[model samples]
Target chain A: DVKVTQSSRYLVKRTGEKVFLECVQDMDHENMFWYRQDPGLGLRLIYFSYDVKMKEKGDIPEGYSVSREKKERFSLILESASTNQTSMYLCASSLGGKGEQYFGPGTRLTVT
Target chain B: AQSVTQPDIHITVSEGASLELRCNYSYGATPYLFWYVQSPGQGLQLLLKYFSGDTLVQGIKGFEAEFKRSQSSFNLRKPSVHWSDAAEYFCAVWSGSSASKIIFGSGTRLSIRP
Candidate 1:
């Protein structure tokens, strides 16, 4: 089975603090994505990486950045956490084709 | 721009009752479509996907979906819903030239009643 694991299932951070969310996929997929899910708003893409050291901005990339130093891992960074950034963060990975994506359990972050 | 719409925000159905969740999409071409289910606090799981060929597709957990080109809809249906089926369902589409991104619908939350 394809497994995507996130660093933390839940986290609490103070305002202005930097937060890092890690994700690792064992399937060796070439594409990885970071999305923040909010009530009513649904899941909005934050960033995505197509290849190692290559990344692209998604619909809502203003307050978040991503890193893909290696093929198996992707990290999402919140430069300075804020109350508005509190949400469930999800990481997904897929083969770069007509393949379905596999998602991590998710990291629920609370910025207070 | 490409987008997905799930008309219903939530739906309630009794155990063993039939269930249907509506989903519509606006895309320039025939889009890659998918139906995913997410239990509370968990990641989304692929229930079914429709790319081409037969319009009707069977998925895991006894769920199925049909693609209607004329209606621009890909609605999910189940002959009988179980209590474990209570979860959020999201309809997603891939319109990008590459499989780099997918636009997901707001999602429909399913509630099961005894």
Candidate 2:
């Protein structure tokens, strides 16, 4: 089975504080993605990395940045957390151009 | 424009009843379609996918979906529902000709009635 693990299942941060969500995948997939899911809105991609040190902005990337220093891990950073940033953050990995993503358990971030 | 639409926001059904969730897309070309299920507080899981060939596709946990090109629909179905089947379902779309990012519907929350 493909295993994707997130650093934290739940996190709480105050306004203007920096927050980090880590994810690691064992499948050696070439693509990694960060998405924030909300009620009614579903999952919206925040950022994605197709290779180490390569990152692309997704639909809702304004308040978020991502890091892929290594192939097996991807990190999402909220430079300054805000109340609006509170949501369930998910990390996913997939083969290059295959489009089938394997998701981690998810990190529910509460920005207060 | 919304690439994918799941018309029903929430659907409730008895344990042994049939279920159907609607999905429609506006993409120009033949698209790759998928159904995903997310249990409470968990990440999404792939239920089924339709890339090409057959229209009717079987998925895990007694779920299935049918792809209709003319109607631009890929609706998910199940003959019988179990209490464990209550979850949020999302429909996604992508294509060889489109960008790498997949478009997902808003999602439908399924609830099982006692």
Best by DockQ: 1
Clash numbers, per candidate: 0, 0
Best by TM-score: 1
lDDT score at residue B77, model 1, on the 0-100 scale: 99
Candidate 1 per-residue lDDT, tens place, B17-46, comes to 999999999998888999999999999999
Question: lDDT scores for all predictions?
Answer: 0.94, 0.90
Candidate 2 displacement at residue A93 in angstroms: 0.9
DockQ score of candidate 2? Answer: 0.56
- Model 2 residue A18 lDDT score: 94
lDDT of 1 at A36: 96
Residue B63, model 2: Cα distance from true site in angstroms: 0.8
lDDT of 2 at B62: 92
> Candidate 2 chain A, which ten residues in sequence have the lowest lDDT sum?
A93-102
Model 1: per-residue lDDT, tens digit, A1-112? 9999999999999999999999999998999999999999999999988899999998899988899999999999999999999999999999987667889999999999
- State the DockQ, from 0 to 1, for candidate 1: 0.72
TM-score (chain A only) of candidate 1: 0.98
